[model samples]
Target: MQTRNGDLSQQNGAESNSSSNHWQSQIAAVTRKLGSLPVQELKLRLPDWRNSLSTSENRLCDLLLAIQCSNSAADIHPKLTQARQEYEKFKFLCQTAQRVLTQNLTHYDLVSIAKISTTVSQPNTHDSAAGRSPALPVALRDRGSFDHFMQMWCIMTKHNVENMPKMGYKLLDLFQLYIQVEELGGLEKVDTEGLWHLVASKMGHVPNSQDATPISHIVKILSGAFVSVLAPFEEFYKERMRRTAAHWNICGPNVTPGTGIVPTEVHCNIANFGVVFGEVNIGLNDWMPEWSPYAKILRLTGMDLDQMQQQGWTDDLIRLITKFKPTIDAWREVLIKFLLEIWQHSQSMTGQHSLQHPCRPTIQFPTSQVPCEVASTIKGAFSIDEMQRAKLVVERLTQDILQTRQYQTCEVPEVQRLQMNYAVVDAHSLAIQFERIASLDYIVFDDQERTKTHLDQIALLKEQHQILQSGQQYYIMSLEEVVTAQQNFRTALGGIKNACVQKVKERQQQVTINFPQPDEFLIRSLLIKKS
Candidate 1:
C-alpha cells in the first residue's frame, strides 16, 4: 500500500513538471514575436501598453526594447497583451485627430463670430496649442509627431469636399495655433503689414474687414506658414548668390550651358513644397489680391517689396527678380500646394546648385534678345485696316531684306574691306531697327479715336518710320550695285539712323515713359490705367 501511494505522487509530480515546460515555451514564442515589431510600431504600442500594464511612461521605450531584445520570453506574456491594447489606443488617437481636423468649425462652437470681427492678433503674441478646449495631443508639440495628423488631414480634406471650406477655416485656426506654439514667426523678422499690403495691392484693392468668406484669413494663415517654411530657402538663395557672384561675373551670366540667365543655374530645392521665390512673387503680384481678405493674405505671405530690395543687389539676384516680372499661371499649382502644406505637411527648404531634375520647367522665352520689345511688338500688332496697311509695309520691308540675295555680297572693294573689318554690316541691322520703330506705331495709336494731339504725334512717328524704311531699302539697293554711290549709301543710312533715334524720342513723349516698377509691365499697367 505504501509503495503504491509513493508511485502515484511520483507520476503527478512528473506531469506537473511537463505542463510547466510547455507553458514556458509558449510564453517565449509570444515575447519573440512581439519583440520583432519595428521600433516605430513598438513606440506606438508602448504608449498604450504603459497604461495597460501600469508601467512607468518614461520607461515604456526601455521596457519595450528589453522585451524585444530579451532572450527569455517567460516574463513577457503580460507585456505582449498590453502592447496589443496600446495599438488600439494609437488607432483611436489617429481617428480622433482626423475627425477633429475634418469636421467643419462652423458645426461646432469653434470660433466665435466675435473672433472673426476682431482684428489680427497683436504682434509677437502666440496662441497656445493647449488653450483650445480639447487640447491637441502632447506629442503634437513636436512638429514631426504630427505626421499622422497631417496624413489624416489630407485624407479627410480630399474625401470630404462639402466640408472643405470649413476644413480650411479649421485648419487655419489649428495651424495658427500650431505656429504660435511652435513660435515659427519668431524665427524670422517678417513684415506682416507689408505682406498684407502686398496682397491688398495684388487684389487691386485694399483689404476690407467686412469681406465675406474669410478667404483672406485663410490666405494669411497659409502665407505665414509659407513664409516660415520658405524663409530658409530665401536666405539660402541669398547666400548662394553671394558665394557664386564672383564666379558668375568671371564666367558670365550663362553658368549652365544653354541656360542663358544666371538665376536659372541656381536650383531651389524646398523639398516637395513646389514653390519658388519667383512663384511667391507672382502669387503676391497676381493671385492673392483677388481673394476676399486681401489684407490678411498680405500679413500671411510677409513678402515686402523693401525686403525684396534688401535681398542685396547681385547681378544674378537682380536677374532672378527681374525674370519674374510678367504674371504667370505656373504659381496656381504652387498656391494650391502651399495651402496643402498648411494641413498636409511642413515643407523643407534646402537650396542646391543641382537637383535630380528642375523643380519647374525652364521657362521658354522666344529667341528675342530684347524680350520686352518683342512682347511689346506682339501686344502692339495692328487690328485697324489703316494700321494693317502700315504693318504690311513693315512686313514687306523685312521680307525684302531677307529675300534680296544681291545685298548679301558686298560689291565695292571699300565695302568688302569694311565688311571684313566688321565696320559695314548688311542692311539687316537697319531693317530690324526700322521694324522695331514701326511696331511701336500701332502701340502708340492703338485707339481708333485718338486725341488731336496724339493723332498728330502718331502721324509724325509713322512718317519717320516710313522715311526710315524707304532709306533702309535704298541703302540695301545701293549696297548691291558695283558702282555703289558711297555718298548716297552714307546719306541713306544716316537718315534712317536719325529717324529711328528721333522716333524713339517722339514715342517716349507721346506715351509717358513710366519706368517699370519692380515686377511690373510698365506698358501693360499704362494700358490698364489709361485705356
Candidate 2:
C-alpha cells in the first residue's frame, strides 16, 4: 500500500511538470510568431497583443535565462531582435497608457522602462563573433545587465502630479535637514547647487499645459519653508546688534565730554537711530517737507535752509529737538556773547563812540539825503562792510584771547617767571650802558676812559639786543606749541565727525530703502532731531 502511495505521488508530480511544459511551449510559440514579423508590422501588432503578455519579473527572468541558454544561433538572433523590438513597443504603449490614465506621471516608471529595455537588448557572454556561445554564469557575467535592471526598477516607480505635493514636502524637508547640518559644521560645508539639483531633479516634472496653479502652490510652499528655516537667523542678527551697541556705545550722543559741548542724550539717541535706520529713512526725506515745523523757521532765516530740510524727519523727532533745546540755546548764547565782546573791543580800539555807549559805534551818514528806496538798494553794500569790520574785530579778539588764555592756563609758574625775568634783564642791561656812557666823556683830548666807556656801552647794547631776541624766540616757540595743541584738538574733532558720518553711511546702507530730495524739509527735521 505504501509503495502504491509513493508511485501515485510520483505520477501526480510528472503530470504537473508536463502541464507546466505545455504552457511554456504555448508562450514560446506566440513569442516566435511575433518575432518573425517585420518591424512595422510588429509595431502595429504590439499595442493590441502586449496586454495579454506576461510582465511579471519571474516570467521575464525565465525568458531571459532561456534566451541565454539557447544553442540555435539562426533562431536566437531573430528571436532576440524581435524580443527587443517588442519590448520597446510595449514600453511606448505603457507610457501612452500612463499619460491617458493620469495627467501627471512619475519619473520612476520612465526610468524603469528605459533601464529594462537597455538590459534586454544588451549582449550576453554567450554571444561571440562566429555566433558561438561562451561558458559564463548569467549573473556573474551580467554586471552591466544588473545595473540596467536596477535602472528599470527606478523607472517603473515614477510619480505623477497627484504625488508632487508629497514629493515637494520631502524636498523641503531634505533642504532643511541639509541646511541644519551645514550650519552645525559651519557655512563652508553647505553645497547649495548640489543639494538644489538633487531635489529639483526629483521634483521637476510638470504637466504639458498652461495651468500654473499647481506650480505656484509649490513655489509658495517653498517660500514659506525658506522663511521658516531662516527665522532663527533673525534673532541672531538682533543679538549681534545688541552686543555691538553695547560695545561701541553707539546709542549715545556723538559728543566728547570735555573738549567741547555736544548734543544731549535725546539727540544722541535720535542720531543713533538715524544711523541704525539710515537707508530705511530715505523716504522720510519727502515726508520731512510736509511734516517739519522748523522748515518754515529756516526759510524765514534767509539762510539757504532749503538745502537742509531734505528727508528722514518724522513725528517722533519733536521729542529729540525739544530734549536738546537747552544745549542749542547754550551754544547760541556763547556765539552771541563772543560777538558782543568783539564789537565792544572794536569800538574801544577804533575810538568810534556812539550815543548809546563807549562800547558801541554810530554811523555818520546823513539821514535826509539818502531816500529809503536808495538806502534799501545800498543796504547789501553796507552790510558787507559791517561784516568785514566785525570779522576783523573778531580775528584780533581771537588772537588776544588765545594769547591770554595760554598764559592764564599755564600750570608751570616758573615758565612765566623765566619770561618776565628775561625782559627785565634786557631792560637793566640797556639802562646800565646808558649810565656808563653818560659818565665817561671827553671833549678835546683823547680820553681812554671815555673811549673804553663808549666801547663798553656798545658791547652792552649788543648783549641786551641778543637777550631780547632770545626771549622773543622763546615766546614764538611757546605760541607755536599752543597752536599745535589746538590743531590736534581740531583733528580729534574731525575724526569724531568722520567716524559718525561713516557709521551713519553704513547704517543708511543697511536700513534705507529710499532717499528723499535735497530740498525737502524732512531732512532738516531729521538733522535737528538727530542733533
Candidate 3:
C-alpha cells in the first residue's frame, strides 16, 4: 500500500512537469508583434526564456543603423527575412496562447469574467496547462491579465491621442514593425488580438452564458465594447481639434526676431501626432482580417474601412483653420509636414552640392539626438520646427521670384550682367538667394494680409534674376557675339555707350535705397485680436 501511494505521487509530479513544459513551448512559438508591453507589466507575464535585457531588443536597436543599412534593396531583403523568422517564432507563440485561452474559456463554456478583470494573476495549477501548446504572457492567456493590457492600452490611447507628440518614437517603431508583420501576414488576416485589445475588458456589459457561447455572440459583445471604448476618444478629438482649428494662428505663431523661425512646440506636437495617427490607421487597415465573418457586410457597411487620407496644403492655413469641422482628416498637419520636407530639402541643398536622395528628416534618424532635459523630440539639433521655418522661407522666396518673373529676366544677358546676381536662372543661384533672404527673417506679407516694404527689395531681386537668365541665354547663344558687341561698342564710341549705362541703371534706385531695417526682419504675428 505504501509503494502504490509513492507511485501515484510520482505520476502526478511527472504530469505537472509535462504540462508546464508544454505551455512554455507554445509561448515560444507565437509571432512577434509591434505592440510594446508596458514596462511595469513586463515581468507580469508567464516566465519567458528571454532575459530582461533581451525583451526590449526590438525597440532599443539603433534605428539609424536599421534604416541606413536597409536603404539598399540587396541588404533589406535578407534582414527582412531574418526579422520574419523572429516574427514567425512570435506568431507560433500567439497561436499557442490562443489555444490555451480557448481551452481556458472552454471550461466556462467555464470562463470566469470576474477573475479576468483581475490583473497579472496566474491561472490555477491545472488551468495553466490547459493546452499542449506553448505558454503566453499572463496578459494574453490569463483572464485577469487581459484586463491589465486592455486598461493600459486605453490609458495610453486616451492620453497619447490628446497629446500626439507624447506617443513619440513608439508610434514610429510600431509602424515599422507593423509593416514587417503585414508583409508576412498580408492584409487578409483578421487582427484578432486588436479586436480583443480594443474591447475585451468591457465584456462585462454582455450577459454571461453558462452554456457554450457562439463566437458571433461573443463578437457582438466585443463589438459593443469596442464602440463604448472608442466613444470618449472620438468625442475628445472632435472638441479639442475644433479649438485647435479656430486658434491655429494663436497655437502656431512665429517666435521673435534673431531667433530662427522654426516650428513652435505647438506645431511640432500637432505634426508628430498626425504622423502617429497615420501609422495607427495603417496598422489597423493592414491587420483587419479581410475574411472576417462580417467581411461581406463590411463592403456595404462603411465600417472598419481604411482610416488614412491625407490632403496637401491649402493656400491659407489661417483661413482653413477657422473653417475646420470635426472630421478626423481635418486635423492633418499638412502645412507642418510640407514645411518639414521643404526645410530638410533646403538644409541639404545648402549643406551639400549633390544628393543620394531627397533631403528629408526620417523618423528612423538617430535616437540620441533627443536628450532627456529638453522633454522634446523637436528640441534636438535638427527638429520639425526648423523644417517648418525652412518651408516658409523656401516658399516665400520661390513665390516672390515666380510672381515677379525674375527668373525670366536671366535670359537677357545684356539686360542683367551689370547687376542682379540673385536672379541667376541657369543654376540654383536664385534658390540660394531665397534661402539667404528667408534666413534674414524678413517679414513679407503676413497672415493678416498686411504687406511690407520688402516689395522694393523683391523687385530688385527679380530684375537680377531676369538679367542672369538673359546672361545664360546669351552665353549659350554665343559668347563670341557678346565679345563682338563689346568690341564694336568700345570702338564705335558714340551711338549707345551712354544708353547702355542708363539701361544698366534703369532698375537701380536713384537715391541710396533705404534697405529693410533690422527690426523689419522679424516675422509678423498672425494673431487676430478678439474684438
Candidate 4:
C-alpha cells in the first residue's frame, strides 16, 4: 500500500508539471500575437493592468482558501486547478514584462554622475594645468547597466525614499574616485564623445523610441533666464532677466563697480522665485521636504512633475535620486575639507602652529540661527520699557538654543566668554563654544508697536552677544599683553641675579684675604712667656 501511494504521488506531480508547461506555451503564443509596446504607452498601461490583476489575484486567493477548507469540492477540483495554473502563468508574464519596462525607463533618466578628477585653473596661466582625468565608471560609461552602481542619489521628496540610499552611495563613490584621481595626478580629460557613446548605445538598444530627455532641451529651458542684471531693460518685470537678478544678486548695495547698486537698480517680480524659496513655519511634528530651497529647481520643472507621481516608479526613482544627495554633500564636504586642508598646509609651512586649523567640521551644526538674529535686533532697542521686554524674550530664546544640544555648562544670565574653538582638538571639551545665543520670535501683531517690541528684544539679545564677542577679544589681547610684560620682567630679574652673584663672590674673597697665619704667631708668643 505504501509503494502504491508513492506511485500515485509521482503520477500527480507529472500531471501538474505538464499543465504548467501548457499554460506557459499558450501565454507565449498570445504575447507574440500582441507584439511590443512603447515605453510611455507601457508606463501608462501597465499600472492599470497591474491593479486589475491584483484584484483578480486576491479573489483567486480567496477561492483557493475556500477550496482548501472544503471536503465535498472534489467534482469541480479539476476546473479550479486549470484556472489557477493559467492565472499563475499570466501573472508571471505580466511581472516579467513590467520588470523589463522598468529597466528601460531607468535607462532614460541617467544623471551625469562620474569620477571627479580635478583640474586646477588659477588666475595665472603658468599655474593652470589640465592634467589627465580618471576614467568614468561603468554606470556612467555604460549607463544601461545601472545594476552595478556604487551610489544612487536623489533630491529628497516623500516619493523617493526607496532609491535614496543607493543614489547617495553612487555620488559618494564618484566623489571618492575624484579625490583619488586628483591625488594620483590625473589632470587630462577623457574623450567626451566616447563617454557619451555608452548612453547612445543604450538608447539605441532600448525600445523607448527617443524617450530619453534631450540635453539641448533641458539646457535651453533652465538657461532661459540667463541675463546680466547690469543691463537694465524697460520691461524688467516681464523679462526673464528678473529671475536672473533675483537669483544671482547682480544689483545690490556694496556690489558697486562704477557706483553702488540702488535697491531699485534692477526691478524683478519677487513671485518668480517660487514657493520653494519662500519661508514657511511648520508644526514640530510635520515633515515638509518639498518646501526646501534645495528642491527649488526640481519644482520648477513644471508640468512633467505631476505625471511622474502617478505610480510607484516615481517613488522608487526619487528614492534612488534623493539617496545621492548625502553623498553629493559628502563630496561637497570633501571639497571643503580639501580646501581647508590646503589652508592648513600653508599655515604649517609658514610656521603658524599657534594659529590652529580646524580638523573636524568647524561649520555650525545643531545650532539655532533664529535666536542669534533676535539677539542682534535687541541690541538696537531705543526705549527702556521696550529694552526690558526684549531682554526677557532674549533670555527665553537663550534657553531655547541652549536646550538643542547637551552641554555641561549651565545657562547663565551674564554673557559668558565664547572660546576660539578651532584651536581645540578634543570634541567633548566643556569650554565655552562659539554658539548662537538668542533671537526673538516673530511679532504676533503686524503693528509698529509689536514690531518695535520684537526688535527691541532682539537688540537687548544682541547686546549680550556683543558683550560675549568683545569680552573674548579683550581677553585675548590682555593675555598677550600680560605675557609680554612677564617676559620683560623675567629678563631684567635674570640680569640682576647674575650681577648680585658676581658681587657676593668678590666681597667674600676680599673679607678672607691673608689672615690664615695670625693664629700661629699668637701661639709662638704664649711659648716665650712660659720659658
- In order of appearance, the predictions have TM-scores of 0.22, 0.16, 0.19, 0.22
Model 1: CA > 4 A from native: 1-385, 392-421, 424-427, 436-515, 522-531
Model 4 collision count: 44
Name the better of 1 and 4 by lDDT.
1
- Compared with the true structure, model 4 gives a TM-score of 0.22
- Tens-place lDDT per residue, model 2, 207-268, is 34676435545444543443443233323323333343333232333443311113454322
lDDT of each: 0.35, 0.35, 0.32, 0.33
| Candidate 4 worst ten-residue window by lDDT | 114-123
Poorest lDDT segment (10 consecutive residues) of candidate 1: 346-355
lDDT per residue for candidate 1 within 335-406, as digits (tens), equals: 333333322211111101111121121112211122343333333232346456656655654454446423
Q: Which candidate would rank higher by lDDT, 2 or 4?
A: 2
| lDDT tens digits, residue span 152-252, model 4 | 11110111223222221231122333233222332222122222222223223223447754644422321221111101111221132223233233233
Return model 1's CA RMSD, one decimal: 31.5
lDDT for each residue of candidate 3 in 312-403, tens digit (9 for 90 to 100):
32334223322221222222233333334333433332222221121111222122121122122112223346546755765675576567
Residue 364 lDDT in model 3?
21
